[model samples]
Target: MYYQCVKLRQIIIAVYLSISLDGVADSSGPYLASGIKIGEVDQTSAIVWVRLTHEKRAHFDKLPILTKGLKRNEKDAESMPEGVARGMAGEVRVGYVATNEKRAFAWTDWTQVLAENDFTHQFKLADLKSGASYSCIVQVREVGSDKLSSTTNGSFKTAPKKTQPVPIRFIVTTCQSVRSIDSGAQGHVAYKTMLELDPHFFVHTGDILYYDKAPLCKNIKQARAKWNLIFAYEHNMNFHRQVSSYFMKDDHDTLKNDCWPGQTYGDLTFDQGLKIFREQVPMGKKTYRTIRWGKHVQIWLTEHRDFRTSNRVEDGPEKTILGMEQKAWLMRTMKQSDATHKFLIVPGPIVGPDKRGKNDNHSNKGFSNEGQQLRNFLAKQKNTYVICGDRHWQYCSKDPQTGVLEMGCGPVNDQHMFGGAPKADKTYHRFFGKKGGFLAVTVVDGKAKAEWMSADVKGNTGKPEIRYTELLGSR
Candidate 1:
């Protein structure tokens, strides 16, 4: 009887989905490159992202012609011209509603068409109630037609108000290499577990997509193609549909290994890479910013690639990783924040000693002077911690000198490549092998507890074990 009931429910859900899709389009070619996703949610606002494909043939002929003469190597290039040919132009709008109840949906006015044709549309939905869940629908229509050509649905929850005593829970993860996805792995197991856990939000530390490495993306067209393929994956789409996410880029996703601004490789320049990164990801104008989850948790998201000095430069007090402006912003934010728990999310490990020595320029040891300064500042602050990714293993450690705990969340689906065995870091209290998983953090009052959940190579995650528990602030 129980099995029969479950089967009937599944059938009903399938029919409902079919009906919902039926209104969007008739017999036509694909209209959406990627479905809707929610990015960068806060107490009263959120960003909705959608990518639209051309409904008919592309409008490349409308583009202005290039007047400059091409270099010998560039003359043979066909990809850039092809990319221009694929451009589309049309109108798109998003309608959204916020409610505490599941069935009660009262959609607000349709937003202006923010983007058109082979482009990403990021619609900012503001003036929402704090800590409320919202459901949204995106619809695309031709320039003159009143009928909608495409529609997709997604949902997200706003952060809690500053005065609210809401308990905060979130998941942290990183490193989804495209190689893993292409190897015929069914779907990421860790993502499946995350959906079941259903945290308030998800944090991707960095390496969101690997473009610089094997099966390298050499041009803008190739980079965009990679982005499309990554987003089209079932696991990624399913995860983003239900949970709001914060994203940052690391070396592999940007340009090359240990990449920084001004570095050029093949046909991909840093500017081009940056452009694609910003367009594909749901981020604001500035990459490094802060998100407050009521009075209990404050997260500082940092950008590691844009302003840093080249890794080849000699190490000194002048050598920096976060760069000058971002470093200053981080310090000021940390000092001024009154949240019970302050989290500084970096793209690489900030506390542990990397076994690779100076080659690990992004790690703390390579930028020791700046790292020490930041650590000293954090030491004086109450209830501060550092959460990092880029390392392939999980570790819970405290800086011996500053007593700031740094928790490393392992790769999401990529093969664990480094930091498997416990290195000789005296500050490290717990270490897990090269297994892909994420960190689940729970905060109550001024205290926070973290659980390091482990998953196998195939993405099968096991039970989450308590890794660290402590008072966030000095009482």
Candidate 2:
């Protein structure tokens, strides 16, 4: 009887805190705490992701490190740090206009951000002009109320028309672990240095965050908190606010290390992990896609975790990674493309001297059957190249047998560099770097050339040193 009475009192207090003295639902101002992400951009459309929070910025307090072997009892054992971005229920609307154009703003109806989706909403803006820069503003308000909360501004550049001969510059990076972050609240120095080059867009090839690492996330709530904690940093939020990006998922971000379709990380299922990824970022119906950036470049962004055979499965003809449908689409698209250069941006290496005994990606001996088949096709194509992520170190390699070229974009910071070749393998690697860095590619249509630069990350204020540069294709 005493326990029942206490439970009732707790419930009464919760209701009182949620409601006002006037008995109205408490509708307070919602702020843009996570900033905004613009992705899946093309000539005619782009998706803008937004989230409403209870505070102006994410809490900056640090979470306590977990004790060893205590995986499932984190919530009970230790309190979560205040550094998380607390989501709130609210409505969001977007308005956009082409940059430098004296035109009326195009607006969308207010859409509510729900708790089930981590208080996030993605607005798809269509009919945008090709090769044009767009200025966007997002407005937030309380649910069931007309009063405005605040407005945040962002910008992105649309891909040029298919036939237009335009030059393009973009950055590709991978394997950024929050635990490996060198800077505190400032986030990764790679973000600031990449921004300095003024890329048209950025591609995070995968391993955006480490879910299975220490302070393990074993459930949906904990997983969601992980996203809030990583993106809350000033550098991450500021970079995404300005640059349009393409986000991919690998084993770590999806669920666990080397995860497949049917696997589960604790109570978190594979399907739930997929849903969380889509909810957190701006994406379209299809995860695998090819976006054309004028006549010079066409980039194929492949999905790694969504469709694949189990890593534990025996290696054979039936052992596959890209799956049948995606493989078919990739082959068909490559055949029909007339672009000067074609880039297959994958979450893992295709021609890697990856650390031995690691059997997950195409680089491993386990997947050699399928890997060789894909490598053979790429070698025959005109000026085609594979730009990959997932490796901690950076390298440029050419398959000895197939003659196909590949560039591995290294980790975001120096602390994350590991498992790289101790000495450059003269047989495969034309260039290799054990330090942290990113890949910057420039495609010049008029000159009919592409420049690849592998840069080494210095400190936050220090300039990134260009370690290597290569002229790709017929220059």
Backbone clashes in each candidate structure, one number apiece? 2, 1
Best by TM-score: 2
lDDT of 2 by residue, 1-475 (tens): 3235324433433443343223222345687777889999999999999989998776655453311122223233343343377889889998888865887779999999998899999999999999987777777888867766766666778999989997788899988755665567766767767766667789999888877875567788878877876776777786786677999989899998889998898898999999999998899998899999998889999988888998888899888999989999999999999988899999999999888668998989878899989998998899899998998887888889888889887877666764444567889988888866788888775443223333434566445677777678841
- Residue pairs clashing in model 1 are 88-117, 383-472
Model 2 lDDT on a 0 to 1 scale: 0.78
lDDT of 1 by residue, 397-475 (tens): 7777677778888787435343344455655555544556788888876568877775432224344444434434442
- Per-model TM-score versus the true fold: 0.82, 0.88
The candidate that achieves the highest lDDT relative to the unseen native structure = 2
